[model samples]
Target: MLIDSGSPGAPATIGISLTINGEVRELQVAPWTTLLDLLREDLDLTGTKKGCDHGQCGACTVLVNGTRINSCLALAVMKDGAEIVTVEGLAKHAGQDGAMHPLQAAFVERDAFQCGYCTPGQLCSAAGMIAEGHATSREEIREAMSGNICRCGAYTNIVDAIEDVMHAGAAR
Candidate 1:
């Protein structure tokens, strides 16, 4: 809970500790601060885009405790002590100095990102979806990834890229 600072309007900040991109970070955040804002504004991790600002667009997707959630819809303080992963962390966890994550490599190989605005969210969402191990086929993948939208109309290529990684068993 946020306490008023005894003033007319400023709400006191609450301390939150979140493990982001494998780094443990302790910070203060206002109760109303959204995870997207905390990541982009406070932490300067702008890889997670803020599109629609509502839950409809998957542009603000991020993995919290290994599960994908819409960052824009999530309160930063609510995820205190949680482990979060963004697009920037995927490659680092992929095991090498310059290697890209399988999904990242596949997306590049298949030209999955056109305009690229939705790529970050798509990548994070795909990573989380793959980890869930629910998408078994092309149709299933499409259904599972339906929550993410690409305005550049890269649906086919995105699906193909994800399918490639999924079939190659490179993604967990």
Candidate 2:
């Protein structure tokens, strides 16, 4: 478990602990603070971008016990002892020497983003989506990633990038 300092506008300040990536961290946070807030503001893990504070956007997506979930919609207090994996975590696990994840590389190769604001969430969602066997086709990938809005309108490139990873995984 991990906890960090609370934000100024955060709710009730309290101590929090959670398993992030593979490390346990404890921090002082507000009771009403969201997981995204804690990760970005407290833990200094800004890889998970905040496109929308509401669940409507998947920009703040992360893996909770290997399942993809919106961090913005989850409260820090509710994630005690939960295994959380953020974009940074994914990159680390993809290689020991800081090599990029296959999905990340594919995204770069495919030019899957424009402003790159949504790239982190898209990559995280794609990683979990592919692992969960939720992406079977271009249509399926589109449907699964519908929650993540790419304001840059790079949907086609995003789908192509995800497909590249899926095919590569299948070949392996």
Predicted structure with the largest lDDT when compared to the true one = 1
Against the true structure, what is each candidate's TM-score? Answer: 0.93, 0.87
**Clashes by residue pair, model 1:** none
On the 0 to 100 scale, the lDDT of residue 104 in model 1 is 92
lDDT of 2 by residue, 1-172 (tens): 2343345554556676778988888776666779998899878999998887998879999988878899999998788778888988887655535778888888999999889988889888888898788568899989999989988899999999899889888311
Off by over 4 Å in 1: 1-9
The superposed Cα distance between candidate 1 and the true structure at residue 138, in angstroms, equals 0.5
lDDT of 2: 0.83
Q: Which window of ten consecutive residues has the lowest lDDT sum in model 1?
A: 1-10
**Candidate 2: regions farther than 4 A off:** 1-13, 170-172
Worst 10 residues of 2 by lDDT: 1-10
Mind sharing the TM-score for model 2?
0.87
Best by TM-score: 1
lDDT of 1 at 138: 94
C-alpha lDDT of candidate 1 relative to the true structure: 0.90
lDDT tens digits by residue: candidate 1, 106-149: 99999998889999999999999999998889999999998899
